[model samples]
Target: METFITYVSQNGFYIWEEFYRHFLMAAYGVLFASIISIPVGILIARYGKLSSWVLTFGSIIQTIPVLGFMAITMVAMGLGTTTVITTVFFYSLLPIIQNTYVGIKGVDSTVTSAAYASGMTRLQLLTKVELPLAVSVIMAGIRTALVVGIGIVAIGTFVGAGGLGAIIVRGTNATDGTAIILAGAIPTALMAIVADLVMGKIERKLNPVNKTATA
Candidate 1:
């Protein structure tokens, strides 16, 4: 406890900066993954036939060892934040993409039929009806990706991408580094918890079922 307290007092600034770096790395990764995955998911949902192949490809990427992926990526991108961000971006895709595909597919057929009956075009039905109804499920997927990104960002340190992982790496290298490891681990865990909780609230708000229940 005393050592932990001392470490905190001494390294508070470093912790804050690293935490921010970790956040930026995770945020950019999740943001980019969400941007790409959601659209791809939509396309898959629309086509249906492509869903299996597209998701299988994403699953294959996820199955690759993270360290090996980083090592391979480093050969192309070199060791830096860019490599980390790109790797993390890939890591985040599956959840968001899968969720988005499921969400769009799960939208009520009756609602889509009504939209068509009302003279809505396919594009209009998607944008105005399907997407809106699927918002909650999509948000849930994003939340999952966000948490995954947070955990994975720590590994960024291996490729010279600075983050809370640096603290853990340092601790592992040091003779008495438990305090340092705890310092990083605690905050990273806290950040993931906070993100999950906040995103959960947002997901609930987006859920039409919840709204109807409240009404």
Candidate 2:
């Protein structure tokens, strides 16, 4: 307890800065993944044949070992933040894409038909009806992607990317397993919890029943 407290007191700023840096990198990765995946997912959901092929390809990418992926990226991108960001971006795509595809596809067909019958254009039907209804599930996917990205960002330390994992590596080299575990475990857990809470709040806000029920 004393050692942990001492470490925190002395290195809190450094730890916090590293945590924030990694968080931003992970966020960038997720944001980029969402940009690519959400539109593609929506299109795939609208077109069955395309959904099959895109998902199959995404699944193949997901099957690649994370270490191998990062190692190759480190070589290609040459050991910096870019390698971490790109690797995390690719790692994040599968969940977001899958969830977006499922969410939009799972929206009630009757609702879509009604929108179309009511003279909504395809764009209006998609934006105003399907997407709003699907937002919660899509947000869930984002939550999943964020958590996964955070974990992988820690591994980014191995390739010269900085994070709480830096402390862990330093601790290990200094023969202090306690520091490694504390540094790695605490920040990761905190990020996961905070991400889940924030995303959960957003999901509830987007959910009509919850909003109306509260009102």
For every candidate, C-alpha RMSD to the true structure in Å: 1.0, 1.4
Assess each prediction's global lDDT (C-alpha) against the native.
Answer: 0.92, 0.87
Give the residue spans of candidate 2 off by over 4 A: none
Query: Could you tell me every candidate's TM-score relative to the true structure?
Result: 0.97, 0.95
The numbered model that scores best in lDDT is: 1
lDDT of 1 by residue, 133-212 (tens): 99999999999988988888889899999899999899888899999999899999999999999999999999989988
| Backbone clash count for every predicted candidate, in the order shown | 0, 0
Question: Per-residue lDDT of 1-215 in model 2, one digit per residue for the tens?
Answer: 67877888888898889889889989999999999999988999989889888988888988998879999988888987899899889988888889899989988899999999999999999899999988888888898889888888888889999887777777777766685558766987899789989988897888766767889
